[model samples]
Structure formats: structure tokens, C-alpha cells
Target: MEITLVEGDITAQRVDAIVNAANSSLLGGGGVDGAIHRKGGPAILEECRALRASRYRDGLPIGQAVATTGGNLPARWVIHTVGPVFSSGEDRSVLLRDCYANSLQVADVLAASSVAFPLISAGVYGWPVEDAVRQALTVLNAVDPAHVTEARLVLFGADTYTVAERVAAGFS
Candidate 1:
């Protein structure tokens, strides 16, 4: 897949899919989750509520992903994945990778050629921004080229987007 890095509001990206850095509840909380819910409108929440009532009553599992309508947002669909809380005592890197991996899996299932992502877990979840960028780039770089034609790292600030650009450039 082709990985593009940009500092922008993910809600405005006119892509096929946009990944949500959701909490397990999937009901929408602060940071990226709240923005997506608020901008995407009630249709997104309605699907989330239904998902909770059926498949995800206990909440979405960390590292796993599911899809909902993007509603009023520019994208056609939202791939929601709960990222693990960063912890120093454990190797949560795998869970972090799964967040990106599973999101891509869902995107492919929808035949989405272009997808945009936020820096999952780097906000209130307390993941280091640089490391989060590295992980996102690494996982996205590893996907089968045919599975996704373009993957955009839709970062929110100059610092985060700069780091993502540097990491994407030097990371093998």
C-alpha cells in the first residue's frame, strides 16, 4: 500500500474509510472518538448502539475492529478499533499493531482503496507520539500492496505529523 502522511482533521478526508481510535465502549468518548461521533452524526452512533446490543455488548475488544457508517463525514465508512492503554510494564506493542492491522483487514473487506487513520492511542491513552508513529508506519508498510491502494496518516498537529513524516521516510 502507498502510505501518505498529512496533518489534518480526519473527519474531512474524502477517503473510502477512516479508522476511529475508539474506546472499547464504541459509544464515543474524548479525543478522536468524540470528534468522529460528533461530526459523523447520529447514524454512526445508531450502528454502534446496535453493535453493542448484539455482537459487542461487553464492548469492542482491544486490537479488534468493526465498521460503521461514516454518516455526515467525508468517508463512506468508519473502521472502529480500540487501542490498548499504553503501559510500561507490558509489551503492548502487539495490541497496538493489531489496531492498525485489523483496521486494514476491515477496509479490505469493504474493498476500500483509500483509508485514513489517526495516531491511535497517542492522545489521552498516553502512548508516546513518536513511537506511535513508528508503529503505525510499520504495520501499514507491511500490508499487502493490493489490499489497500493508499493509506493516509491523518495526524492532528505539526509535531505529530512531522514525526510521522520522518518515521515514514526512515523506517524500514
Candidate 2:
């Protein structure tokens, strides 16, 4: 898949799918999760509630991903994945990478051609920004999805976007 970086709100991306850096709860929290929930409207939450009631009675586990309606957002679907929190004492990079990989898997299953993703765990979860970019690219670059044609890493700030662009250049 072709990978690109965009400096903007992920909720505004007009793609086949938008990935959410969700907490295990999946109901909604701060940062990207809250923005997606608020902008995507009630329909998205309704699906999440239903998922919680059925498949995810406890919560979405770290590294796993699931899909729901995008609702009012520009994207057609939303892929919610719980990112592992940054841990200086232990290596949780595998779980972090799984956030991107599993989300792409879910998108492919939904037959989505394009996906937009936020920098998972880089905000409130305290993951170092540069490494977060690298981890995201690591999974994204390796994937050969049957349906996904493009993946956009949507950065919320100019600084983050610049870092993503610089980190992305290394992959070239």
C-alpha cells in the first residue's frame, strides 16, 4: 500500500476507513478517540455500545481492532484499536505495532481501499513521537492488503507532521 502523511484532523479525512486510537473501553476518551466520537455522532457510539454488549463485553483488548459505522464523519467506516501505553521499563512495541497492523486487517476485511490513522499512543498515552511514527510505518510498510490501496498517517500538528514526514523519508 502507498503511505502518505497529512497534517489535519483524522475525523475530516475522506477515506474508506479512519482508525481510532481508542482506549480499551472503546466508548470514547480524550484526544483522537474523543474527536472521532464527537464528530462521528451518535451512530458510531451506538455501534460501539452494541459491540460492547455483544462481542466486547469486557472491552477491546490492547492490539486488537474492530470496525463500526463512521456515522457523520467523512469516512465510510471507523476502525477502533487499543494502543499499548508507553512503558519505559518494558518493551510494548509489539502491541503498539499491532495497533496499526490489526486495524489494517480490519479495514481489508471491510473491503476498504483507503485508511486514515492517527499517531496511536503519542498523545495522552506518553509514547515518544518519533518512535510512534516509526512503529506505525513498520507495520504499514510491511502489509500487502487485498483491498487497501493507500494509508494516510494523519498528524494533528505541524510539528508532528514534520516529524512523520522526516521519519517516512527514511523508509524510502
Number of the top lDDT candidate = 2
lDDT of 2 by residue, 20-70 (tens): 999988899999999999999999999999999999999999999999999
| Predicted structure 1: lDDT | 0.93
**Could you say which candidate leads in TM-score?**
2
Q: Note the Cα lDDT for every prediction shown.
A: 0.93, 0.95
In model 2, how large is the Cα lDDT of residue 41? 97
Clashing pairs in 2: none
lDDT of 1 at 141: 80
- Candidate 1 regions with alpha-carbon error over 4 angstroms: 145-147
Model 2: per-residue Cα lDDT at residue 8: 96
